[model samples]
Target: MPRSPLALAALATVAVPGLDAYDVRRPAQPGTDYDVAVVIDAHRRRWVVRAPAGAAAGAALEAEVEVLDALAEHTASGALPFAVPQPVGFAHLPEGGRAAVHAEIPGTPLRVDALQPGPGLAADLGRALAALHELPTSLVENAGLPVYEATEYRQRRQAEVDEAARTGKVPPALLRRWEELLEDVAMWRFRPTVVHGDLTAERVLVADGRVSGILGWGDTVVADPADDLSWLLVAASPEAADSVMEAYQLRRTELTDPHLQRRALLAGELALARWLLYGVRSGNTEVVEDAVAMLEDLDEHTRSLDAESSATYA
Candidate 1:
C-alpha cells in the first residue's frame, strides 16, 4: 500500500527544522522505488520529501542522499550552469526506514514529445549534458561511485543481453543485433567520463528556454558518456536531436568520439532488453509482457526498414 501524503507531511515537520506551518501535496507521479511529496513552509520555502517503498529502495535512497551531499559541496564554485538539488534534512520513519528532504529546485521537467525546438531548449539541454559529462572524474571517484572502463562497460552490457536471452523471451534478431554491436570493439573505444547514469526526459528541468535544473542523482557514475545521450536520441524528434548533438559537440572541450552517436543509438535499443530483464528478475509478468510486445514491434520495424533499403539499392 502507498503511504499517505498527509502522513508524510507530518513526518516532514518533525524531520525538518523550524518548519512550524507547511502544506504537503503529492508531487509528480511516484517513482518506481519511492513516494515523493512537496512541502511548502510558511515562509514559502519549498522542499521535497522522498521515502523508500522497499528495502532495496531504502538503500538506493541512502546512496542518493550521499551523492547529493557530495555534489552540493563539490559544486560550490558554481562551475556548472544549472542547479542541483541539495539535501537539507533526514528523518527516521515509523516503518523502520529513512526518508530525505531536499531544497526544491526551480523549473519543471521537459516533455520530450511536446518540446518545440525554436526556443533553444534543445541546445540548452545539450550544453547542460556536456557540462555534466565534463565534470572532473574525481568528484565521482571521491564519492565512492562505480567507475567502468570501455571494455568493462561493454562486457556488462553483453552480460545483460545474455541474461535476457536466457529467459527466451527476447526476439532472436534483436538479440543478435545487440550481440554484434556489443562485440564491435572499434565502436566501444571512448574515454569514460562522469555520467548521469539514468538521464531520462523527466530528470531534466527547463525554465525560460534554458535547462534550469537537473534532478535524480542516484545513478551518477564514471562510465561511457553515450549512456547519457541515449534517452534524447530515442525520445526527441530528429530535428531536436540533431540540434542537441550539434550544440553538445560545440560545447564539449575534448575531441568528439567518432562512434558516440552509434553507441548512443545502440544504448537506446538495448533499453528494452534491460527492462525485460528487470521485469523477469522482479517477477512482474505485466512488465515482462509489455517489454516482449515492444521487442516484437521493434523487430517488425527493423525488417520493414531493411526491405526498404534493399529496394532503394535495387
Candidate 2:
C-alpha cells in the first residue's frame, strides 16, 4: 500500500533535519517504487519526499542518490541542459528500506500527445537527451553503474527474447522478428554511452515550451543511444518525433548509427515481453492477460504491414 501525503511529510522532517513542512501534497511525476509527496517548507521552498516500495526499490533509491550526485558534479562543470533532483537528506525506513528528501525541480511533466512538430519544445527535448548521452562515462562508472559493450548488449537482448519465448505467450512471428534483429551484427554497431535507461513521458519535465528537468536516474546505464530515443516514438505527431531526432542528431558530439531509428522501434516493441515476464513471475493474471492481448494486437498489426509491403513490391 502507498503512504499518504501526510505520512510522507512526517517522514520528510525526519529525513531532512530542520525541515518545517507545513503543507504536503501529490507531485506531478508518478512513483512506481516510491510513495511520493511534495512538501512546502516555511520558506515556501518545495521539497519532494519518497519512501521506497520494496527492498529492491530501496536499494535502487540509495544508489540513485550517488548517481545524481555524480551527474550534479558534471552539470556544474559543463551544461547538462536540464535539472535533476538534488538529495538533501535521508532517513532509514522501519520497513527495511529508506526515505529521502530532494529539492524540487521546476516544470510540469511532458505529454507526448501535446507536442509541437517544429523546433520548439520538441527540439529542446532532443538537445536535452543529446547532452545526457554526451556526458563522460566516468561519472556513471565511478559511481559503480552497469556499463556494456555493443556485443554484450546484443547478447543481453537475445537472452530476454529467449526468456519471453519460454513464457509460451509471445507471438511466434514477433519472437522470430526480435531474434533476427538481435542477430544482425550491423544493427548492433554503435558507440555505448551514458543512458537514462528508463526514460518516459513523465520523466521529462517541461516549462515555457522547453525541457527544464529530468526525473528518475536509478536505471542509469552505459549502453545504446537508441534506448534513450525509444520514448520519443510515443509522440502523437510524427513531425514532432522527427523534430526531436533532428535536434538530437545535430547536437550529438559523435556519429550516430545508421539504423538508430529501426533499433529504437525494436526496443519499444520488446517492452511487451518484459511486461509479460513480470506478470508471469508475479502471478498477476490481469497483467499477464493484458500483455498477451497487446502482443496479439501487435502481431496482427505488423503482419498487415508486411502484407501491404509485399503487395507493394510485387
Candidate 3:
C-alpha cells in the first residue's frame, strides 16, 4: 500500500533533527513495522525516535539500554574509539509502549553503495572492530547483556524461509538450495567473541575513506565474531575480501581453526537467507535478488571448502 499523503507530506516537509533530514530522502524503501521520527527541536537539538511494537517493546528497550550502557562503559574507560550514537533520554510510552530517543550524530551515514576501495579501508574497519572486541567482555556481561545464540540464529532463519515459502514468494529452487546448505552443521561451532550481531550495510558508517562509526547496536551480542564478519563478506568486493581477511587476521592472529572459517561462511549464508525473507515481507526486489545471488555464491564457496576439508582429511 502507498504511504498516506499526510504522512508523506509530513515526512518531506518536517525539519529533521540534529542532522539534516533534508538529505534523508524517504528510505528508497520503507523500514520495518516500527515508527521512526528524526526530529530536531528549536534549540537545535537533534534526536532519533524508534517506536517499535509494545509487545516486544520492553525487551527491546532493555536491549537498547544495554547497548547504550555498553557504549557508555567503553567511553568511560576510553575503550570506545569510534563515534557511536549516544542515548540522551528514554521515556516509557503510555499504555505499555516503548520508544528510545537518541542524540543524532552530525555526519551523513556512510552508505555501503558509496564505499570506495583503498589500501587502508579494510584495516580501518578491522582495527575499529578490534577496538570493539578488545574491551573487557567480563565488564559488559556483569551489566547483564544478551548474546545472540546459534539456536536463535537457526530459528530466525527458519522463520523467514517458512514465511517466504508460505507466501509463494520464494522460488522452489532457491528454497531447495538453502535446505541443502543447512546440512553443514560443523559451521556452527566457532569460538565465541563479541559481535555486533546485525552487521549490515545500513549499520556501517564511513567518512573520509575511513570507518567513522558502526551503528545499530540494538542487536549487539557477545556471540561469535563471525557474525560481524559476514557483513564484511557481503559488503566488500571479491578482490577486497582478501584484504579485509588479511587485516582482520593481522589484528586477530589466532584464527587458524577451519571451524572458525566455516562458522563465518555459514553466518554469511544465514544473513543472506534472513534478508531474502525480509525482502519478501517488505516487497523489495533489489534486496531479494541480491540476497539470492549472495546465497548462491556462498553455496559454491562452501562446496569448495568442503572438498578441501575432505582432501585434508585424506
Point to the candidate with the largest lDDT: 2
lDDT of 3: 0.60
Each model's lDDT: 0.85, 0.89, 0.60
lDDT of 1: 0.85
Q: Write the per-residue lDDT of candidate 1 for residues 81-162, one digit (tens) a residue.
A: 8888886778897777788887788988888987556438888788888888888888888778899999999999999889
Candidate 2, residues 1-314: lDDT per residue as tens digits? Answer: 88889899999999899999989999755467889999999999999998998999998997898899988876677679888998998878887878989998888889898888887998988899999999988878988889999999999989988999999999999889899999899999999999999998888899888888899999998998899888788445898899999999999989766988998988888888989989999999999999999999989989999999999999
Comparing 1 with 2 on lDDT, the higher-scoring candidate is 2
RMSD of 1: 1.8
RMSD (Cα, Å) of model 2: 1.5
TM-score of each: 0.94, 0.95, 0.66
Candidate 1, superposed: residue stretches over 4 Å from native: 73-75, 95-97
User: Over the full model, what C-alpha lDDT does candidate 2 score relative to the true structure?
Assistant: 0.89
Off by over 4 Å in 2: 28-30
Q: Clash pairs of candidate 2?
A: none
